[model samples]
Target chain A: AQTVTQSQPEMSVQEAETVTLSCTYDTSESDYYLFWYKQPPSRQMILVIRQEAYKQQNATENRFSVNFQKAAKSFSLKISDSQLGDAAMYFCAYTRAGTASKLTFGTGTRLQVTL
Target chain B: DAMVIQNPRYQVTQFGKPVTLSCSQTLNHNVMYWYQQKSSQAPKLLFHYYDKDFNNEADTPDNFQSRRPNTSFCFLDIRSPGLGDAAMYLCATSRGQGGQETQYFGPGTRLLVL
Candidate 1:
């Protein structure tokens, strides 16, 4: 069984600044996927960014990026030029490369963007 | 605008009452999934349908059931609602299962069991 862990339960970042949410996972599979999902107050889950284990280059999506360290089993999300809209509960998820593989998610980190 | 749509964004049901949540996708994806998320918690997979094939998680309670009549529609049925069952139920879809395929999610239905 794979487990994702987000050590920080809450994180705060000033507007226009940057914030990084840490995530770590335990998985023996070499080929897997890591994802960061944002759930706003409306409770709508949105995909932030994703990283493939085999890809050495980190994945970047607009202001959202991931620091994927396969050797350390760490996949952290970094939000740059953060805006108030970035405030939400961020979750780190893992899935093995296969058919019908379910996602294993971290506890979550609540991000707060303050002025 | 291909997307996943969940009906009755908010629902309130009495204890032991039966409730059903519906999900429809315009993406015409082959895979549809159901997830349960409690307050301040991550979304937990309950079950999923790959076309007509149903896959349920091992720990998923039998109280929860699912139906996928066609390619576009899927349903989540709670046989007997309990207070513990109150949570946000989310609907998601994907083209297929793989590392590159991304799962698109709906807004979700918040279920309140009284």
Candidate 2:
């Protein structure tokens, strides 16, 4: 079974500053996928970024990026130019490559963007 | 735009009562998943449908059931609601079963058991 871990339970960042949320996973599979999702208070969860285990290069989506270290089994998300809207609970998830594969998610880190 | 839709965004049910949550997708995805998320916790996968096949997680309670009438619609049925079952029910859809396929989520239906 794959398990994702987010060591930080809560984090805070000043508006316009950068913040990095750490994530690590324990998976035996060689091929897999990693994802970061954000859920605001009373809002829907949305995808932040994704990284494939095979891809050595990190994935970047506008202000959100991922630092994926396959060998270390770590996938961290970086939010640049953080805004008030970025304040939300972030989750890290992992899944194996197969049909009907279930996603394993971390507890989550509550992000607070202070003005 | 194509999106995942969940009806009855908020639900209030009494203990032992049965409740059903509906989900529809306009993306025409091949997979639909049901997840349970408690307050301040991560979303936990309960079951999913790949095409017409139903897959349930080993740890999922039998009290919870799921049905997919077609590619565009799915339903989650709780046979007997309990206090522990009070959580946000999220419906998500994906293009395929690939590990990298992005899952689009619905707004979620918050279930409250009184």
Candidate 3:
């Protein structure tokens, strides 16, 4: 079974600054996917970014990005130019290729954007 | 825009009572999934339907059941509600399986068992 871990239970970032949420996973599969999902207070889970294990280059989506280190089994999310709207609970998830595609998720990191 | 929709944004059921949650999609995707998310925890997979084929997770309790009448709709039936069953139920959909395809999520229904 694959497991994802987000060590930080909560993170704080000042407006316009950057913050990184750490994530690590234990997976034997070489071909897999890593994802970061954001769930706001409203309880809607939104896709923040995703990274493919085979890709060496990190994935960037607007101000959200991921530092995917397959060798270290680490996948971290970086939020740049953070805005107040970025406050939410962020989760790190994993899914293997050619399978049920059921996501195994980390405990989650609650991000608080402050002025 | 085509999206996944879950009805009864909030549901309150008494203990031992049965409840059903409905999910519909306009995207016409072949796969629909149900997830249970407790407070401050990750959403756990309950089951999913690929077209009309049902797939339930090994850990999912038999107390939970599901129905997919057609391509656009799926239903989750909890035979008996317990306080432990109170949580947010999420519905999602994708075109196919594997890690490549993106799954779009619904707002989720918050269930409270009294």
Candidate 4:
């Protein structure tokens, strides 16, 4: 079984600044996938970024990026130029390769962006 | 744009009443998933249907049931709803069962048990 952990229950960031959300997971499989999802007040879940275990290179979206440490089993999300729209609940998820596409998610981190 | 769609954005049902939530996808994905999310908590997988095959999570209560009649439609039926079952029900779809495949989510339906 795979378990994802997000230590920070809440986080705050200033507009135009950067913030990083921490995530860790326990998985026995060598090949897997890690993902970060964002849910806003509207209750829509949006994919932020993802990283593959085999790929050492991190994944980066326009303003979102990730720091994936395979050895430590850590995958953190970095939000650059944070905007008020970035304020949402973030979740970390894990899944193994060649299995049912069920995702094990962390508790989630509530992020607040301030002006 | 092709996307996942969940009906009845908000629902109010009485305790012990049976309710069914519907989901449709235009993406023609091979997998459809149902997730339950409580306030301030992460979404938990309830069950999923791959093509026409149903897969239920180990911890998902037996009161909850799912049906995938076709490639684009899936339904979640709660036989007997309890107060604890009041939460957001999300429908998602993916292209395949690959670990890296991205799952597109619908705007979840919020169920309120009276």
Candidate 5:
């Protein structure tokens, strides 16, 4: 089974600043994918970004970028220019490349953006 | 808008009563998944259906059951509601079984066991 670990339970960043959330995963499959999801107070989970295992180039989406080290099985999310609306519970998830609709999730990291 | 839809955004049911939550997807995805999330916790996978093949997580209790009659509809049935079972249930779908396809999620059904 693929397991994702988020080391930080809580993180705080000043508005317009940057923050990084750590994530590590254990998987035997050679090819897979990594993801970050944000759940705000509305409790709606939205996709932040994704990384493919085969690609050495990291994945980035606007303010949300990922530093993916495939050899080390490390996929961390970096939120740049954090805003007040960025305050939410962020989760790191993993899934194999094929025939797997289920995602293995990390415990969660509560991101708080301050003024 | 064509997206994942979960009916009854909120549910209030008596303990030991049977409650059913419905999900419909207009995206025509081949895979559907159900997740259980407690307050401030990461969503846990309860089960998922891959083209009618039900795959339940090992830790998921027998009290929880799901049915996907067709490509567009799925249901989560709690045979006997328990206090512990009260939580937000999320329904999601993806075009295929692969992880990179992006699983679209519904707003979710918040179950309250009284």
Candidate 6:
């Protein structure tokens, strides 16, 4: 079984500043996938970024990036130039590679962006 | 654009009444999943259809069931809705290719038990 944990229940960031959300996961499988999902007030879940266990290089998408530490089993998300639109509930998920792959998600962190 | 669609964005049902949530995908993905998420909680996997095979999560209650009639359609059925069952039901789909495991989600159906 895989369990994802996000320590921060709520986070606040100034607009145009940067913020980091912490995530840690426990999984026995050597090869797996980690992901960050953003759910805004609309309650729609959107994919932010993802990282593969085998890849040491982190994943970056526009203003969103990730710091994946395979040894520590930690995967954190970083938002650069945070915008008000970035305020949302962020979730970290884990899944082992397979046909019936199911994502195990964390409790989620609520991010607030201020002007 | 091709995407996953869930019907009845907001559903209100009486307690103990059976309700079914429908999901359809135009992406033609081989896998479809149903997840239940409570307010401020993470989405929990209920079950999924990988082709015709149904995989249920161990922690998913027996009161919940799922049906995948075809490759592009899936349904989540709650036999008896309790107050505790009131939550958002999310439907997602993903194509299996090149170790693809990412799932694209729909807007979700918010079930309110009265």
Residue A31 error, candidate 3, Å: 0.6
The lDDT per prediction is: 0.92, 0.93, 0.92, 0.93, 0.91, 0.90
What's the lDDT for residue A62 in model 5? 95
For candidate 3, the C-alpha RMSD (Å) to the true structure equals: 1.0
Pitting candidate 5 against candidate 6, the one with the higher TM-score is 6
| Per-residue C-alpha lDDT of model 2 across residues B3-25, encoded as one tens digit per residue | 99999999999999999999999
Q: List the candidates' TM-scores in order.
A: 0.97, 0.97, 0.97, 0.97, 0.93, 0.95
How does model 6 fare in lDDT?
0.90
The best candidate by TM-score is: 3
Cα lDDT, model 4, residue A61: 97
> Model 6: per-residue lDDT, tens digit, A33-110?
889989888666888998988999999999999999999999999999999999999999988865366888999999
TM-score of chain B of each: 0.98, 0.99, 0.98, 0.99, 0.98, 0.96
lDDT of 1 by residue, B45-110 (tens): 999988899999999999999999999999999999999999999999989977567888999999
Better of 1 and 3 by DockQ: 3
DockQ of 2: 0.74
Highest-scoring model, DockQ: 4
Candidate 4 clashes between residue pairs 3 or more apart in a chain or in different chains:
none
Docking class of 5: medium
Arranged by DockQ with the best first, the candidates are 4, 2, 3, 1, 5, 6
Question: For model 3, how does the per-residue alpha-carbon lDDT over A10-115 read when each residue is reduced to its tens digit?
Answer: 9999999999999999989999999999988876688889898889999999999998889999999999999999999998999998876788889899999999
lDDT of 1 by residue, A16-84 (tens): 999999999998899999999998888668889989888999999999988989999999999999999
- Model 2: residues >4 Å from true position, as ranges? none
Cα displacement (Å) at residue B94, model 3: 0.8
Number of clashes in every candidate structure?
0, 0, 0, 0, 0, 0
Task: Judge candidate 4 at residue A15 and give its lDDT.
Answer: 100
Flag regions of model 6 displaced more than 4 Å: B97-99
